[model samples]
Target: MKTFTSGWAFQKPDQNYFKKFIRLNNIAIDGIVYPKKILADIEGIPVLGFDDAHDIIQPDDLVLDVSTNPDLRKELEPFFAAKDIDCVSVPDYLDRLLSADQHDALLLPVAGIKASDIRKLKSAPIPDRFDAHFLDAESYEVASKLDGIFRHSQWQRLVEFDRDDPTGNVLFNVLLDLHARGLLKHLSA
Candidate 1:
């Protein structure tokens, strides 16, 4: 599952701040996966709070400078509550962002490849050096994989053929380059 929190750096409580925060908030709310827990430290407890601001924090807890807008905060509460996303004050959100780990779900409205997929590219030939590297062993391996899959399938779908293989990254990257160069026909989503 993906995770996300709303964060907006505000100089003052103004129309611009509200507009920007709403745009950012929509991204979190409309996401395929919302954060299940909001990071917070309340009353010496490392608390995970949900949409209810009162449940997450006490008045004694210091409110963030960025979250001073009661009007915006109040407006956002219901939207967050409807989506069941944990809401924290901006200060807590900032802290959570800084300390966020791989397991920590951030808002992911769209799908993206994992870091492992990108790392796979290193084992593939640098595509532009085609003449020098084409005859090399690694380049030959990449070419074989590319020849196997070409424009016959989507890169993501094609990668499933031994998707974990390093050569798969080369094939995928080459496909992207080909699509970029207008050599391959791109299927519209």
Candidate 2:
């Protein structure tokens, strides 16, 4: 009965449909739609404002904080820690998940997973077209900061993050390789 409290992007309109869909599948998830920062339920797995989000997440839940502000983790970690919950900013989460020989992230599922012996959360979504939805000021800030990271990485060949990616797996994999080779800082830096 773990809840995947994803940090959703702003203005996502599928919360209602997603809540209904989860109810039909009996996944024990509540599609909490925050008016200030909408969360994505599908493969997009968008981000949301973490301040108010802690209220909705239950103990043992994992929150994906997508704010580009590096200080956000410092602020969130202690709060979630007090509540017995786990939290990770997007980049940090990916870096850890893709790390090898140094972490236990391999236990986590990549796309979908084997659930309840049969019902599966199949992996598929529209091409996301996230650039279209990233019209918010925060999105612009995140994009700008991450763009600087891409330009500054020592990956030998250019590593570009596809804003249109629905699942953000590109950034995750890149972060893993860069971190492994010691070519990048902690999280796709």
Candidate 3:
């Protein structure tokens, strides 16, 4: 039972590949500290939304391949090392992260919008319709801003498909199989 921890900053189109990988691998994941208002849905997947990764990570669990940001990696390295936990590189761990059951259903369309659009939405004023739908005033305000940005930005164009249309399961199983085979190694001892 390997537990995985990741950061919320990795929640983008290019990085969704890893998210789908983790979901398919059936790896229990935690330590994504995303704001609730920002998350569209997790679809009952086990997740912890906090302000920081340090809040959710324990010394015993493994930290998966994170963003390219060196500062964040540096901040987390000591924590994992102190706990005697294994920190695996993203490339090495990607396979195991994609080995979950293929029965999970897709919720949103298998496409991405632009980051500029998303940014625009995030900055936009909250509409009455959004305020009513979300119920929470704060959520409505935040969502409007996020919506604006997501709709306007070219960044959203980066999203990739998460499943095979025919099988309805994640398309990347070989990565997980490799991880299960002990081909993956820890970044820190």
Candidate 4:
């Protein structure tokens, strides 16, 4: 029932046969591909998977959105009312799930450093391979913008500071490096 609508659905496509079925032989299923139509049936409920966007839907599939898609809402409401399937708005769902503690859990906290430790922290060279792999200009921009505590929105804004780099992996790796170096602490509740 919990579906991510903001392209934040944590998923990796199964690199297997039926996935290939979509790629290789769409004609076999009347041109209905995995993402183009309902990808599969999950316990009698059709599951539609989308990342950037979806232009299609079947009556039986579960779809997630942000309530911003009025056209889709109008189209999908009959199915939802009949309990034939579910249509969920992720932002609304997130509002229901998020509390102050839940909100705080998502922040990355910068560790407090003493003046004495500043030199050590600076002198401690980042490993060359790690630097080469993760520390690009984008990553540096992200890292430099981290505060004592910050949320994903702040981090996202920092990532998009200079240019529009929507690829989150580089920013993730940069944060991961800070975590590895004991400079960043992720709070959980």
Compare the candidates by lDDT and give the number of the best one.
3
My TM-score estimates for the predictions, one after another, are 0.21, 0.28, 0.36, 0.25
Per-model root-mean-square deviation over C-alphas: 17.3, 18.3, 22.6, 18.0
The C-alpha local distance difference test score for the whole of candidate 1 amounts to 0.40
lDDT (0-100) at residue 118 of candidate 1?
27
Off by over 4 Å in 1: 1-9, 13-66, 97-189
**Candidate 2: where is the Cα deviation over 4 Å?**
2-55, 88-189
The per-prediction tally of clashing pairs is 5, 8, 42, 0
Error of 2 at 118 (Å): 22
**Per-residue lDDT over 1-189 for candidate 4, one digit per residue giving the tens place of the 0 to 100 score:** 122221111232221222232234231221111222344543233444442124344444434442334655564455344444454543333233233323233222123422223323335544343455455765655554533112111222332344445557677777778888877777211
Worst 10 residues of 1 by lDDT: 27-36
lDDT comparing candidate 2 with the true structure:
0.43
Which pairs, if any, clash in model 1?
Answer: 3-105, 3-106, 3-107, 4-106, 4-107
Model 2 residue 133 lDDT score: 55
lDDT of 2 by residue, 54-164 (tens): 566677565654333345445555666676766554444334333331433232221331122111111322223255757676566555554443222211111233236
lDDT of 1 at 91: 29
lDDT of 3 by residue, 1-189 (tens): 445554346445665644564465455564442323245335443445433444555665666645456766665556566557677765545322222213333222224532233334546665665444787765665555545433432123234223234232333455456666777544211
- Model 2 — which ten-residue stretch has the worst lDDT? 113-122
Clashing pairs in 4: none
| lDDT to native, each model | 0.40, 0.43, 0.47, 0.36
